[model samples]
Target: MKKPLLMIVGAIAVLAAAAFLYPNAPSGNAAPPGKDAKHGEKGHDEGHGAEGVVEMTDAKVAAAGIEIVTAAPATLHDSIILNGILQPNQEALVQVTPRFPGVVREIKKRIGDSVEKGELLAKIESNQSLSVYEMRAPFSGTVIDRQISLGEYASEQKPAFVVADISTVWVDLSVYRRDLPRVRLGDAILIDVGDGGDPIKAELSYVSPVGSADTQSALVRAVVANDGMRLRTGLFVSARLILSAKQVPVAVKGSALQTVENRNVVFVRSGEKFEARDVEIGSRDSENIEIVFGVMDGDKYAARNSFVVKAELGKGEASHDH
Candidate 1:
């Protein structure tokens, strides 16, 4: 009986030693590291182990429409925006009038008709001699207004036709009293005519010496080439007057900027990885921004569609939380 009791005691001691040697050991079903079925053996998600980083392949980037641009020296404009309207270049507009009081006998052109230089517009019968004369276009232009019709008495007091060469249009911008001193002739201007088109580039051609007392604004003029006649007369437009421009050593497209965790960040590219780096910004224009810190010259960054990378980083954080 004593020997059997000692044997039971030794068996209990052996079991206790085994438990002590393998303390906190995984269960029989538990798989080793890099062999987990749910995580595909890896502890972290693919391309997402580091914080504030997103990984995307070249094909993925192109498919996402992410435009990558290199940081470089760029000219940033100190600009002021103003509202304006497009007008026909008055210098190129001409008013056609009968030289003498006459009767209109023939009408050859109408409003919106394209005419050439010396193009016959109408025939007028003189009242003084009962003789006929011809009205011709003074230059190549579109007939914007027609004041006379056939079989009507015409006079020299009123214009017979109004023609305008609209190949180049005028942008009349309103300069407020506070901004008048900053505006000057020959300063660069960009006219946004809308319709999702690019802004038309021009130079300040004129600044009115007179200011309207009612509006308290001066009229500033810029002549822009009206290619395709997109800058039609009477259409309101917005303009950016470049008051000053400065070159910075490091700059990136404005589209690359994003706010992350209450801080401004620019996503910099490193092979397949995009790291959100906190950046200090300086002067900024409509297109580009100056990076005072956290980015260097020649650094490649995601320009267009950079928000996609930010979303990806957010996903990583959410998954980590779970």
Candidate 2:
């Protein structure tokens, strides 16, 4: 009876121990503290937390579209840009000055009136010498300025009417000193009169050898045929001198280039990050500039405003060093 009681007591104690330990045991095997199980849980939680933080902050970073280009041997026709005023061709502009002093009796043409060659513009009743002199239009053109009116005094040296031929117009382009080498006598030019139509094409007729000391620009004259009588003198126009050759090296938009440390640089997209690269620059048009070095063809580059990426990169570098 004593032996059986002892065996039963031991069996009960063993059962209680097994029940208590089962709850505390790991699902697979009993792992040591701070070992694989504990460490794996901690790491997984940290990983998830880090990923959440990244996702939360990613919305603030602005993204820009980028383009990949390749460098090829291209002809870069360099040019000088200048501002110029439109003037009538010398052969077409006529200033009518009276030969003798007289009193103007009648005025035939007014401002903005179109006249023909040999057309009588005004009839003057002379009182100084009692001789009547009739003023006629020298060329078929529009009257731009009328200095004399009816019954006004007309002097021999005073201009009476200013006539300008609208059949052919001149575009006086202001070429900067830097672009003087690119301008030639026969280069093609495009002139925009801001009339909401296509630009007019013309050929460069002459380039001034001397530059103006005040504006520091040379005058380049282009002659355009105005058979339709569309262009007018003194109309503010934007001129574009087209070069015969394409830009060499690689060309990118001007907005894409930025200054860093007083040097020109462009952000190149690489994988998930952008790389800052210094570049050599060349001639530039209004919208695009020539890239002399640093970028290769087919390499994706950030376009539009890329300052955000540059700031982010700067922060990243700082953080890495820290």
Candidate 3:
């Protein structure tokens, strides 16, 4: 009887120690070791934020300076990029040189001044006749350069003024021999002015049969209409010649392209919110990119400043300590 009693007291002491040591153990909802990966994946999916969907207010869109453009069918060209410089149309350019050796007496036009054809530009005292004579413009144009000043020595060898009609200009492109075979006299040339302006369209008018001594490239000239004087003489420009033309049924500006969640995407403006939509691209040119799958023609997407949407989406999906 005494032994049984001692055994019961020892059992009671063990139960008391167990209850004190393990008062708050894991419940039924507690996860197992292998279950952690499952929970982590769930959090990841939530944090990824529905792939490309980004929502914001109109005020936020305007404040972010997001620009939107309509995707549409566009005429895309396969082009060969060329480096070149803008020059005055040689047909419209004139060098006004003195006919007789003389001393400059008076000057009227300066560089960048405009004069009409047969307009008086300067007066010179003839060395032979000892009398003053006037120099007139040969063509209506802007004075691009003036090498002579008032009272300076003037002669038949020196040009008094160089004028060029900039209503049109020439884009001289350096074409490699390999490109010569593809380039034609009537091919279209797009000249990039580098001022974020529209490219000036020109047609290849001349291609030198001979190559250059320094670069081994032939000179190819394209005449472009420059009504606004956008193309300036000696201005460095990048150009491309269209080899083939094709219709891109659906296309968007390259600036609209963005990478979201490791997928090619475009921020499509849906009503008041811009949603990031996945895209499958086919072909791309210097300005426009062809859309193969994701987006459709006439769908509006963010063009300039689309990165703002990307930034906002990034902030929304930013990780937090749980």
- Which model scores highest in lDDT? 1
Selected candidate, larger lDDT, 2 vs 3: 3
Residue lDDT tens for model 1, 1-322 = 9999999999999989989998876778787655686765465565456888888999999999999999999999999999999998999999999988899999999999999999999999999999999999999999989999889999999999999999998899999999998888999988888889988889999999999999999999998888887878989999999999899999999999999999999999999999999999999988999999999999999999999999988999887655
Error of 3 at 47 (Å): 10
TM-score of each: 0.79, 0.57, 0.71
Clashing pairs in 2: 69-297, 69-298, 70-297, 70-298, 71-297, 75-246, 76-247, 76-248, 80-179, 82-174
Candidate 3, residues 1-322, lDDT tens digits: the string is 9999999999999988988998875557766443443554335455444645677777888888887789999878899999999888889989999888888999999999999999999999999998999999998989998878878789899888999999988888899888888988899877889989988787899989899889979999988888677778898899878999878899999999999768999989987777888899988887899999888878989898999888877776675223
Using TM-score as the measure, which candidate wins? 1
- Cα misplacement distance, residue 127 of candidate 2 (Å): 2.2
* Models ranked on TM-score: 1, 3, 2
The stretch of ten residues in a row with the least summed lDDT in candidate 2 is 49-58
lDDT string, candidate 2, 66-87, tens digits: 3433334445544434456767
**Winner of 1 and 3 under TM-score:** 1
